[model samples]
Each structure stands twice: as C-alpha cells, then as structure tokens.
Target chain A: MDRNRRVSVEEVKHIAELAHIKLTEEEETLFTEQFNRILDYFSKISEVNTEGVPLTYHVLDLINVYREDEVQESLGEEEPLKNAPKREDRFFKAPRIV
Target chain B: MKTGGIEEKRALSKLYELTAIEISEKIRNQEISTEEYLYSILERIGQVEKKVHAFVTVVDEKALEKAREIDRKVRKGEKLGCLAGVAVAVKDNICTRNIRTTCSSRMLENFVPPYDATVIERLKAADAIILGKTNMDEFAMGTTTETSYFGTTHNPWDLRKVPGGSSGGSAAAVISEEATVALGSDTGGSIRCPASYCSNVGLKPTYGLVSRYGLISYANSLEQIGPLTRTVRDCALLLSVISGHDDRDSTSVNLAQKDYLSFLQDDIKKLKIGLPKEFFEEGVEEDAKGPVFEAADKFEDLGASCHEVSLPMMSYALAAYYIIAMSEASSNLARYDGLRYGYREENDEGDFDTVFSRNRRIGFGAEVRRRIILGTYALSAGYFEQYYMKALKIRTLIRRDFERVFKNVDVIIGPTMPVLPFDIGERIDDPLKLYMCDILTVPANLTGYPAISVPCGFRNGLPVGLQIIGKPFEEGTLLRVAYTFERNTDYHKYRPSL
Candidate 1:
C-alpha cells in the first residue's frame, strides 16, 4: 500500500508487452506515473478488513446457470466473415506466425 | 396535419419540444407527419450539432425512409407500436446491423456491425426510427466525452462545458432535442452522470433486467444499457420497451417483464429514503449537494421517511469498482485484434505479437491505454491478490454495506455527480479527479442495483441530478421515486437556451 512503491520503467514496458500495446515515449512516461498513482489510491482497498469476506465474482445470486442445450440459428457462414479485414476462401486471413 | 390556430401552428414547428409519448401520439393520430418530424430533427442536428457534437453517425436517409414507411403504415389503418415512428438516438457502443458500431475508438472507427443489439431490435419492433449513433468516451472509459475519438460533445446547457460521459452524447442528444430519447450503457454512472450534467433523466436498469445481447462489452459484470430522456416517465417508457428476458444474453434474467410506465405515478408515500452520508462527504460542491437534500425534503413532504445512512466501506467502493472494471475491460477488449474486424494494418508485416501491439497502440486512446496497463498489472501474478482479489473482497464488503442499509430503507438517495458540469477541459487530464466525480454513482453498478437520475434542482443555472438507487430488479420502484420527485419540481423542465 506504500504510495512510494512504483513500477519501474522496465516493469511498465513488460506490462505493455503483456497487454499487447506498443506505447510511445510520452504514453510510456504518462502511463508509468498514472498507473502508480492509480495503484496508490486503489490500495485503499487493502486497508479494509476483508478477512473471511468472500469474493463477489458476480452480483447475480445465480451460479452455474444451466439451459437446455438446443441448436439455434447462428450468424451464418458469410455473416461472420463480412467484417473480416481479409478473407481467403471463407477463412480469416492473417499474417502467418513465423 | 391540421394546425387550426396560430399558437398551434407555432407549437408544431418545435416538435422537438414534445416528449416521445406526445410525438408518437401525434404521428399515430396523423396530426404530424413522421417524415416531416424526421426532417425537423435533421435540421435541428445541423443547426446545433456544430455546437454540441452529440452524434458520431447520423443515418438521415435511413431514418427518413423508415419514417415514410411508418407514415404509410399509419395510412393503412394499422395498429401502431408504442413508439409509433419516434426517432431514438443510439449510443455507438450498441451494435446496429450495417451501421458502424464504433465505440468512439479508432480501434473500431469503421467496423460496421453485422447484427443488431437486442435493444435496437426491440426499438425497431416498436417502430422507432434510428436517428443516428451518438458519440461517447472511447470504449466508455472516461467521465467526459473529451476522450471520444471523433471530438468532445459539449454540454447543451453551456457550450464551453462538457456533457458528462461516457454517455455524454446520448444525454446531450436528448437535451439538445436532437433525438426523442437515447440509449446509453452505464458501467459507472455513464448514463446518470450525463443526465445529471445535462438536466435530463437517465436510468441504469438492474443487471440482467435489460438484455445486453449486442451491447459491445466493456465490463461484462458491471454495465447495463438503459435510457436517457428528458423526463422520468419517458425513461420508464423506453425501459419497458427494451427490457425483458433474452436467451441470447445468458445472464438476462428470465422473468415477467413489468410495464415500467404502468408502475410510475406521482407518489412516494411511505417510502424510506436513505441519503448515504459518504456520498455527500468530499468533492461534492454545494451546487451538486444542495439539490438532492431539497429533493429528499420534497419526498418527506409527500409522506416519505428520510434519514441519513452510513456505508463505511463506501470510501473504498471507487477503488474496487475501478479495479473490477479495468480488469474486465482488459479482458473483454482483447478481442479487438482486428483480424475479424476493427482497425488493422495490412501492408506493415510482422508476426502476431508485433502486429497486434502496433494496432492496439494506434487503436486505443490514452485513457483506454492507461486502464489496460493498470489492469494488466493488477491481474499479473505477483500483484493479482493484493489488488484484484482484494478489490473483489472489498466489493463483498461494499455490497454488504448496502445490504445493511437497504434492510431498513426502500431506496438510497444522493447527488448523481459530485459537481456540476465543469469546464470542457477542466479535469480530463486528472484521471483520479474524474474518477472522483463517480464516487457517488458507482455503488449501484458495483452492487448491480438499478439507479435513476432525475433533475432535482440546479445550482447557478446548471442542472443537478438526484440519484435514487433501488433494490435489484426494482427499476419500477426507482422510476416511481424519480417520477414523484419530478412531478413536484420544475427542475426537470429547465431547458438550456441554445
């Protein structure tokens, strides 16, 4: 919860890589400062006595909602590909992994 | 269309001043031509849209064509839907088939949806014309429309100020008379905040009450699409048409959907109102705080019991809300890899990681990027428990805090925002300052309760929203309280002179 504890530039770059976002030099600096300040205030939650308090993953009381498995109309073959940036024989075309 | 008197003829010209119910009735009765009404709306958009950039896309041709179809239906002696050829502005985040469903992010600048959001289907079924897609904060992340990739939507009340966001465009559209009513997704005050700032009515329905079927995901667990309108009853009317069980959204509650309009009345008799003390604590200016108390007094005058309640965990609600929202956002937005849709670079070649990173960098705005990185950090191995899990645990306590207060009270009341609509560029740079504005509104979203913002009173001519949060699935009760308050006050009727 120490406000002073900061994510080093290396950590930020590492997080950006993990998040799949390439940051400009300005964004990197801005984010590094912004993230730490946000984390600092967000750390206020740590002071709460949440001992034995269960995590609320969802607000709905229902858990494991079950519905009968039934075949339904889908978006159809061409509908899904309509927005594809590139399509090759009904397949989404992408730069191949090297 | 008959306009016998000079007064009547004059009134007919400002059809934008009429409520959706009135407009629909006029269209149904042949007192007004739907096509003509659409033209006036388009003209109004052209007139004021320069000052209030509320829309990202205006489907004028499509809307006029739809209006003509409705006029023909009217001529055929067909029974009309409740909306009956009314124009409704949609928040861009809600997918409309063939209309670009940009989240006001460059990531999806040109991505036209292949399907209609469930609400859009409902609105269309009700014979409502799609006026256009309203602007919003990029991915609904910021508290102001300033983050909108297209441009900021200025407050209709004061062009120099912001229309509160991320549903600013929808609220502005309704207030500026550009649309009859608009739909906005409220994760954390996205609907109510704008309504508060714009002197309009906005409701964030109970979780699962409105189907989120085609609403582009932001924070799946937190947000719900609801209505923004000029009056509380219109909010209820819109709510009724859009709410029901939809199997398409697995989380949509299967239950008998009540007629929200049928439940509204000028009554709050015996209602127990709890004004959470924390909501009034810091950051709330007198302009924002005074009107809510005045509203509570009015409720008491009408036989409702009012008292102060404390939710000790309230201080941490904002932090917990941000953590959960950002975490969900980071996960939900991961699908925008651009292969299937959205913005992607074609000529610049690289492997998946290299390309995706580049696309996302160019795709997202600064605020969005800030959230993703912070979320990734929170969900990372070492800090996950300390931040996210702990935040979730705090969420439990926050819900319990509300539960404890709700046992003795029917609804919680407070200012929808901490301050009146501020200058356009005032706090956009300070993310924390903007987040603080939502401190009063986030508790409902955090707990999945239905909350409605009604114009209570204004400070220095600016509107203030009185937020009434009710029990889960009790939107009927929330709307009733707001309707009761609105009936007794003239605040909701205050219009900005454009």
Candidate 2:
C-alpha cells in the first residue's frame, strides 16, 4: 500500500477493462479524482494494526450446506430465456469468442 | 383525489389507510370487499403517483384480479392466511414472475423474472395482493433515489425533499398510502434510510433469516429483504409472512417460522438501552439529533434505562461497508453481459470481451459503473491486501464493538439518518457527503444484526426515525420495542398529507 498512491488515468481505464466496463474519457478523469479522494479517506484504516483478527467474509456462521442429489423440476427454456437478446433453438446466442 | 369534506375523508380512510390487520379483518367480516379495497388503493396510487413517483410498475388489473380471487375465497368460507387481501408494494429488485423487475437500471430495463422469489411465493400463499414494483437506485448503489433510472421518488411529506434510497420508492409508497406495506432490501441502509426520511417503520432482519432467492444481488453478503410499513405492527405482520426457511436459498435459516406479531406487547419495563455517543457526536443535524434524545427520554419513561455507550469502531463502518459491498457487487453484477438477459447491444459485430464491456458500459448508470471500477481495483493484484482485506478486518472490529456493547444493553438506539431528507438533488453530486447520511444505519448491516426504524418525532416539520439495533435473530425483541413505541407515541400516526 503506497502512502502517496494515486490512480492514474491509464489505471482507471485498465480497471474498467478488467471489470468489463468501458469508460468514456470524461468518466476516466472524474473517477480518478473521486477514487483518489475516496482511497485517501479509506487509507486511514491501514494505520490500525489488526494483527491476529480474522477477516469475516460472511457475518453469519454458515457451513458447507449439501442436499441429496436428486432429480427435480426445472425451468424450461421458454421462461428463463424470454429476456435473451438473441436466441436460436432455445439457446442464448452469444458473441463469437475468437 | 376525492377528498372534500372531513366526513368523506373518514369514509375513505377505511380504504388505503387501513393497516394489514385492520384491512384483513374488514375483508373477513364483509365490511369491505377485497375488490373494492384494491380499487381504492389503486385510485390512491393514481392520485399520488404523479406527485411521488413511487412505483415503477403498477399492476392494477392483476391486483384487482387477485383481490377478487381473495373475495371468492372469503365467500367459500375457506381458511385465510394472516395477511389475506393486504396489498403489498414490492421493490423492483425482487423477482415477480411475469412482472418486470427492473432494479431501476437500464441494464435490466425489460427483464422479468421467470419465477417468483421465495418472499413473493410466501406473500402469494399468505394471500397478500402484489400492488406493484417500486422504483429503486440503479442496482441499489446510491444513498438517494435520484440515481433511479425511472425517476426520483419524492418524499410525500415534502415533495421538494428526496425519499431516501435505494429503497426510496418503497418507503414513499408506504408513507403516502399508495400501498399498505412494501418489501425492500437493505445492503447499506437502503431500507432504514428511506424509512427514516419518509417516517415509516423499516426493519432489516438478521442475515439469512429471510430467504433472498429471488432478490437481484447487490452485495450478496450484506443485503436482506425486509419490510417497510406505516406502523410497527404492520411491519411485524409482513415480516411474519415473508420470513422462514426456504430450500431455494441455501443461506435461509433452518428454523420454523415465528409469528413476529406475537412479540408485540406494550411493555419494556427494565430493558437496557445503549445510546452510542458516537452516533450523535458528529455531522448529525440539530433537529435530527434532538429527537433521538427525546425518544431516549420517552424510553426512560417506559422504564428502559438509557446510558451513553461507546462503539468507536462505528467511525470506520461506512468505509468498510462500501468497500465490501462494492467488491461483492462487482463480482455479482458480472453476469449481466446482455446476451442471456437484460439490455442488449444492437451492434453485435465485436468479439466477446468487446460486446460484454460495451453492453455493461452502455447499460449501467454512472454511479454503478464507478463503484464497479473501484471494486475491481480493490480486488485486483497487489491491492487486495491493502483495501478489501483491511476492510474485512475492520468488519471484525465493528462486529466485536457491537458484541461488547450488546452484552450490557438489550438494544442500541440512535437516529436513523444524520439529517432530515435533503432536497432531491442537493447531495447527489457530492457522493462522499451523501454517504455520510448513512453513517447511523450501516453498522447493523456490517454486523449482521437486526435493526428497526420507528417514527420517534419530527425535525422541523419532517419526521425523524429512531433506530433500534437488536441482537442477531432477535427480530421479536426489535418488534416489541418498536410496537411499544408506536403504541405510546403519536408519531407513527402522523401522515404526509399526500
């Protein structure tokens, strides 16, 4: 964690890319400033040492929940795929990978 | 729109203003037919929807049909569910089969759920009429309803002020008598903030107490679907209907359904109440701060001892809440690539990454995209240890803070919002300042505790919400306190004059 860390314009673009969100030039600059300000506010947390405190990803004490694998009723393509942008033969049509 | 004389107002009060209990009894006793009641509520929505903009979609025809169905059941002398014929306004993020669940985002503008959410199914079984889906912040991302893609929901109390987000529409609908009750999900104060702003009772149940199977995920770990109602008793009735075990949601608690209404008794003789000094220490507006202490004095009058307690970790809760919530949001929202469902890209000539990114960019609003990018950066290489993990560690500290205090106090009390509802566009631009408004409500979400907001008093003619945070899984106690408050005080009886 760099104390003087600031997100550059390219880094914001890269982050948007990683998140699969395309950003306009205006959003890039605006987000960079907001991010720097927010991150600086957030940096105050690093000062406190939580040496042995375990992180809580989920507040509830949940365990590996399992059920008997059995045949069950399922939603057919007609309803589940109703909102598909493009479909063919009860299947979602997607952009070409290559 | 048909109010002229005070006697006519008295006649119409039997329609939309009835609580779940009173309305259901009226239907059962033939004092009012369900169809007639539904028409009255629909007419109420018609009269107020133009001014408040609470609902994204109103199911007038379907609601009438359901109401008639309940009427037929009543005629048959069939057993009725507890909330039979009660009209419920649902937040658009919850799935309603054959109904659009937009989440107030262009991304899900036309998407409808293929099946009902578990809560929706339970509501149907309870014979509660689904009045409509209310508007919300895009993907439940912001503090004010102004981020809604449809439009902002105005506070019925003051049309100039905002109904708080992201459950703004739900709260507005409940307070305006547009609907008897509403279902809302809270991630970081979404339910309670709007309830505070609009002067309704809102509860965020313990994590996993209510099933979240049909809820559109914002922050999967932090959010819970809860009720916003005109009275605490109505809140309990709705909560009883929607909560319980559901195999559809693995996280749903494995306990038998408890009737929260049974917990409402007019007594809190020796309950210990902690007033976290930190909640009132900074940034709280004068009018808002005054009512909480006044409410504390009322609690003392009820024989509950009020003492100042410290939860210093509250200072870091808002920051940690945003980080964890945004991180989960970035991951949970990655599934909306537009091919399978949701807003579609017309020009489909690009490769997979290009199409996905393009759709997401065009689909999400500015705040949604901003949080997603920040989340992606926090979880990215070299920064995970710095931001996301540190936030989680602070989460433990905050939880410990609550645990340490709850051992001494039965419930923690504070103002639900640091200020009254601001003017609609007042703080939307300054995101940090807007986030500050949630400072009082997010600690419960951060700690997976059950909390309720009941109308305490008014601040400068606007209603104030006094928040009571109880121990996890003790929704019964939370209801007891709020119901007692509502019974003794006249605050909950105040209406917005919509």
Best by DockQ: 2
Listed per model, the TM-scores of chain A against the true chain A are 0.87, 0.89
Residue B217: error of model 1 in Å?
Answer: 0.6
Q: Can you list each candidate's DockQ?
A: 0.78, 0.83
**What are the models' TM-scores?**
0.97, 0.97
Q: Where is the poorest 10-residue window by lDDT in model 1 chain B?
A: B1-10
- List, residue by residue over B10-120, the lDDT tens digit for candidate 2: 576559988999999998887788987887788788788999999999999899889989999999999988888999999999999999999999999999888999999
Best prediction by lDDT? 2
Candidate 1 displacement at residue B287 in angstroms: 1.5
Looking at model 1, give its docking quality level.
Answer: medium
- Native interface contacts kept by each candidate, as a fraction: 0.83, 0.88
Q: How accurate is candidate 1 locally (lDDT)?
A: 0.89
True contacts kept of 1: 0.83
Model 2 bad stretches (over 4 Å): A1-5, B1-13
